[model samples]
Target chain A: MARNPIRDEIAIVGLGSTGFYRDSGGRSAKALACDASIRAIRDAGFEPGDIDGIVGAAEPGGPNPNEMSAALGLPQVTHFSSPMPVAVFALVDAMNAIFSGSCSTVLLYFAYTRLPWNSRSAAEDPFRRHHTLGVMPAPESVNAAAAYAAWASRYIHEYDARREDFGRVALNARAGAARNPLAVMKTPLSMEGYLQARMIREPLCLLDMDIPVDGADAFVLTRTECAREKTRNPVVVHAATTGLVGTNDEDQLPSLRRHGQHVVVESLRAKSDLWLEDMDIFFPYDGFSIITLGWIENFGWCPPGGAGRFLEEHWDPEAGCVMIDGRIPLNPHGGSLSEGATRGSGHIREAVMQLRGDAGERQVAGARNALIGCGGFFFNSQGAILRRL
Target chain B: MSEDVDDAALIERFPYVRIDHDSKHFYRGWLDERLLFNRCDACERFHHPPKPVCPSCWCASLTPTEVSGRGVIHLAMFLHQGPPAPGVDYAMAAHPVVAVELEEQEGLRFTSTVIGCPREAIRIGLPVELGWVERFGAPFPVFRPVEGS
Candidate 1:
């Protein structure tokens, strides 16, 4: 596959987010989007009228481009879209629009008005379908926690991984969250707390699930040269690729450690010149703890099923095994697991901050290159490599 | 009974269906106590959760055939707060759901609940056979552990 020269051609100049809350009572999704977008515009030193492209998850309660344009008063929106399901699709589309010269100075963000899973209205929705373990849509069961529980069960059965191993995943994220001022979860989560956490679905305790948060995160993307002139630091978008390996069959979608080829990593490598080990920070999607384990293994940080062992032996909030600095980090902003759910938008924002040396106390020291892997299911994988210029 | 009356009740019983021109037959088969799956005439491959065209061969010439209803539980979950089922209150009922890969093909997977087995007994690789049960006015296929399995 010929690599598009658009690699590293664009830069992210601004990142903004609302304070992630357990519940923003009566706050409409559009209001959250507006708050995040305006903050991003100012952070980029641009006005709403300067935004020429709009991209995000604009459905259910989110505002469409025209509505958002009217609300934010964007003078023009020549390129606009709201891709379905996966959050990474919006970011990738924004990058392509700029690459194709369709528009410049794009705004990309995500917001959600989450309803409780067991609420009368939420459970009774006819369209509430849950894809179990990435395949086999369970019409009778729309609780996503159940689907993840099944995946965790299979992972435990096949790999003999203990529950404590899963606890380590949650514990690590909480440790990272302690340093993040914007993280919704602040209290330290102990192994005992994780083990005794209420079981929403067997094998997936309450701590294992991503908390439903009401907030929005937005990013501003501009051409690399324009970004340098406008901002003191520009995080170059080295490469962003989407839809690496699709889940077409049940056998292809298991949450257990996959053997043989890791097509997602291969596709990511094909898009950029950076090797996996050179990254100063790793931000894999962590909507569920098990998904993070899969990424840790797939990213070649450790051998298959070695994530449990890796965390036990090498991973620490202050020290890590991957680099000479001893502080190699993942999810410096605490991730969706702790910082609250911005889908993968929070992951992208944090990566940019780390690269700019603007992450404050949680910042990885002297960080130059960062890799952000998005998407947690086998149905698709999206990722990008960002480097400071 | 008139077909229209029966269909109306089925629609009320299971409102979760995406019934359209292509998938109406699958629901109709369920009403007749038949669990139908689409088998592509060209590729001889079976498809679950019926689609208009075979994904592999893109052939619209497909036949709805009843499966053996025998398979092993690939994975199962015991939900403390399950999705709402007909006649069951959301707060009271906890469901044990299973994903069975049918014996007809390696990856022909379907979602159903396993009956007659304790939640503790449900585990990966447990053999199960399909059994029909009525929810509201609709008959749905559920699975149970095979005798002595």
Candidate 2:
């Protein structure tokens, strides 16, 4: 089957975020969503009533798209969907809504509270009965952190990678966060501090994982002509694709190697045509540090077994370095690990920020091109390449 | 089933592990007492929580082999919180948890509680040994540092 081109297509006219924080005061998820939506609408030269479609990124305890549509008094929303983790799937849904003529102007929004709950616990609400429980049942062995840790163990053993290599990524993120005022962890992280930090999962310290935060982000999407008229710096979506390489079953683990080899790398290489080295900036999902390592190799940035060495040699914040060759910047907005968690929406927001040139102090110089990646439940992955238009 | 024992005590001593068909294959079931893990021949890598195939090689040629129960404590943490199941208490420090990397099982790591010691004594890089607790009518491996080793 011929691949669909999501190129030079739906332009993001305006982007707004509530500036992630550990707490959202007493605001409900809907209120947070509305605040971000309002910012995005006004930024795009539109009013609340101008939006015709409502889309949400499915969060554990957040407002539904339909609920948001109703709450915002949009009269009638022609399209709605919650693509969890936001970026790619949300973009796909938004584009479909625009293309199908269901809605010309779409509001893509997401919000959540930071409750410090494990992802493996049973659903606290009745709404999640149909969806799989985020937490594992008791007396059962594995949790999400442990599952990812098991993968980290495999990566280290197979490749002889060092634990310190993972630290480098975290340190780089913290440094990036220091430059980003919106980043939650503004203090510089020393190697001594990182090494001494308590472990959350095997081979993954607390620093290695993304900190959950209560936050919301929104984006305004419209046709190219409308976007140009709406905003001064419209970031065109050059190409966007979401991939589901494996099932949620036990069989998926063994298939990860092949999936990483054939499904992820091969397909991304074909679609983007821009080598990992050619990209100017990267916002690969850092839900876990190992995931970043997995992507470094999967995206063909380096050889499969060479990610550790690449990270070790190239990750130097003091020298202003990036993972890709020739100083291609990475995660300037401190990424998920350093920035307060916007789920994966932070990646999309950062891309928009880079293109809009409003990134302020943390801006990557001459960042005309950016790449963003987001992962979902059951190993679903998505990638987007954006260019400032 | 004893009436004398309180429900908390009864549930506390009862070892439990989630053993689906997938977990059964991952932690190679051996006569309901022993557990084994498989290693992929092509990549020369050991699979933790065993698997029927090599993750790296795509080859189904995997062999189940018994690993030395001994390993280094790569990283360890005491999880104060657990799944909101019953009989869990915040007072019992040992109820938290422990994770270790097996020396023999390259890249293979497991999460288990530190038995026979206070949670405060658990430290990173402590040598630990595998111990089994019966749960759901099967023995599952967990870690405890070797005594006087």
lDDT of 1 by residue, A103-154 (tens): 9889987876565352334334433323122222343442434556777777
Candidate 1's docking class is: acceptable
lDDT (10s digit) by residue, model 2, range A238-342 = 777766543332212442354422354455556665556556788777777777777777776778767778876776655543555646667778878888777
Tens digit per residue, CA lDDT, model 1, B1-149? 22354555555545666466676667777777788889999999988767889877899999998898999988777666644566545356457777888999886777778878886788889999999988756788899999999
TM-score of chain A for the candidates in order shown:
0.88, 0.89
Cand. 1 TM to true fold: 0.90
Report the number of the highest-lDDT candidate.
1
On DockQ, the leading prediction is 1
RMSD of each: 4.2, 7.5
Fraction of the native A-B contacts that model 1 recovers: 0.34
